[model samples]
Target chain A: NAGVIQTPRHKVTGKGQEATLWCEPISGHSAVFWYRQTIVQGLEFLTYFRNQAPIDDSGMPKERFSAQMPNQSHSTLKIQSTQPQDSAVYLCASSLAGQNTEVFFGKGTRLTVV
Target chain B: SQLAEENPWALSVHEGESVTVNCSYKTSITALQWYRQKSGEGPAQLILIRSNEREKRNGRLRATLDTSSQSSSLSITATRCEDTAVYFCATDSGQGGRALIFGTGTTVSVSP
Candidate 1:
């Protein structure tokens, strides 16, 4: 298995521009999660989806950041009018079940908002 | 403040030596997990210890959890260069749905 596949791997965008990150979860996995990693914040959960439905997004910023799971196979995180502070590694993970299951993560997309 | 925090930002050890990393959490949790992330790679699960379980072992890795103190530990025996990575402790929020709260992580360097 390829585990989880995240596209682009790295992205650089001018401030105020939009950035979109994609993740393709492993086959048969039911839960997908998104997290942001930075030196200051460590690893923070942004949102999650189960069975193609958004379960919780309590950690996501109210503005500029949004996530969508259009299908069970893939999900996307979009940041509009990206700011320098938005730069961080966006990680996507999947688990076989919703709770108490081993989670597998993708390499992550390193976003540089300049 | 982070719900969970790992002690010792970084540590170094020679190959064949043993290393231990500690983690403490503020709130109650149903389970705690240990993950390791290598350079340019995503974190991978090492072990999962539930609140009821005090200790669990996987190969040369052992983890201990103290629910009363809300602390956990991971020990690796006979470390190798391949084991050099950043280790993190994640706690289940106990609200269910497997929402994990992660710690800052401990950077471990195992050298030859």
Candidate 2:
């Protein structure tokens, strides 16, 4: 298995601009998840999808952050009006199912909003 | 949000020594997992101990789960410098399709 694939391993965005990150989940996996990691906060869950339907997004910031899984194979996370405080590593992961399964993670996209 | 707290946020040990990291979680869970993440890399699942199981082991790594106390521990025996990395403990709550709630990681440094 290719594990989970995420695009644009590194991204640099001007302040107030937008950035979009992409992820291709492992084949046949039914669950996809997004997380944000930083030196200060460690890792925090942002959102999750099951079978292409969003299951929960309570962890996401109420403003300027959004995520979508248009199909079983891929998901995308977008940040609008990015700020320097938005700089962090965004990671995507996939698991065979939602319960009692081990998750596989992508190398993550390092977003630097300058 | 349910919290998973890990202790000894950072530890430094010499190669060949043994080290242990502890974690505690709030709320019941279906399973608890241990993951290792290298610098500048994604985290990888190392072990998953269901609530019913008390212990699980893989190679040089061993994990113990205590559902009664809502706690878990990951231990590395005969550690190698290559094992140096941040380790995180995550919980699967059996809800919301098994979304994992991760803890603040324990950074381990194995000196050569």
Candidate 3:
């Protein structure tokens, strides 16, 4: 298995521009998760989906950040009007559909907001 | 403060030596997991210890979980240069739809 696949291993966006990251989860996995990692914040949970439905997004910023799982195979995270502070590695993961399941993560897409 | 915190932010050891990484969490959890992330790679699971399990071993890697203290530890024995990585402990809240909460991570450097 290729595990989780995240496109655009690296992204560079001008400040105030929009950035969209794509993720394709592992086959047959029913849980997909998104997290942001930075040297300062470590790994921060952003959102997750189960059975192709959004389950929790409490970690998402109050505005300008959104995620969607339109289907079981794929998901997306979009950041609007990106700022330099938003620069970080975005990781996408998939699991076997349970709270106790071990998650498999992709190499991550490093978003650099200039 | 983070929900999970790892102690001794970083450590250095020679090959064949043993190293231990400690983690303390803030809330109750059903399962705790230890992950190792080598440079330029995503984190990989090393071991998963449930609340009922006090200790679990995988090859040369050992993990201990103390539910009462809300803490867990991971020990790597006979470490090699390839074992150099960042270790993190993650907590599963046991609540539906809740994801794993990760600690900041402990950097382990093994030199030959």
Candidate 4:
């Protein structure tokens, strides 16, 4: 298997600009998850989807951050009016059902807001 | 958010030394997973132990889960320089089948 695929491996955006990250999960996986990793916070959950439907988004920032999984194969995480604090590695993972299944992670997209 | 706290933000040891990382969660979980992440890379799953299980081993790595205490530990024996990385513990909360809350990672540095 090719594993999870993320596009635009690196992104650089000016402050107040919008940034979008893409992820293509493994085929047949029904659950997709988005996480942000930084040196200080470590790994923080941003959101998740089950069967292409959002199940929980409590971890998402109340503003600017949004995620969508339109279908089983792909998902997108968007940040509007990105700030310098928004810079971090965005990671996407997929699992068979997400309960006890092992999640396979993508290489991740590094976002740098300058 | 349910907190999964990992102790000792960083660790250092020689190649032949053994090291252990600890994780404690605030809530009950169906299972726990251990993952390793090198700098600039995504985390990779190393072990998964369900609530009912006490210990699980893979190669030179051992993982123990104590559901009653809501905690888990990961141990690496005979560490190598290649084992240097950040390790994270995630808990399956048994809700929605979509969430796995993660802990602040432990950065392990194994020197040859």
Predicted model with the maximum lDDT: 1
Q: Candidate 2, overall lDDT?
A: 0.91
Report the lDDT of model 1 for residue B7. 86
Candidate 2 wrongly placed segments (more than 4 Å): B93-97
> Best-fitting candidate, measured by DockQ?
1
Q: DockQ for each candidate?
A: 0.81, 0.79, 0.79, 0.74
What overall lDDT goes with each candidate model? 0.94, 0.91, 0.92, 0.89
When summed lDDT is taken over every stretch of 10 residues in candidate 3 chain B, the lowest stretch is B92-101
TM-score of chain A of each: 0.98, 0.98, 0.98, 0.98
**DockQ of model 1 vs. true complex:** 0.81
Worst 10 residues of 2 chain B by lDDT: B91-100
What tens-digit string does per-residue lDDT give for candidate 4 at B1-112? 4378888889999999999999998876778899999876788999999889999999999999998788899999999999999998988655544577788889899998
List where candidate 1 sits over 4 angstroms from the true fold.
none
Clashes of each: 0, 1, 0, 0
Q: Model 3 off-target regions past 4 Å?
A: B93-97
Where does the lowest 10-residue lDDT sum fall in candidate 4 chain A? A95-104
The residue pairs in collision within model 4 are none
Error of 1 at A16 (Å): 0.8
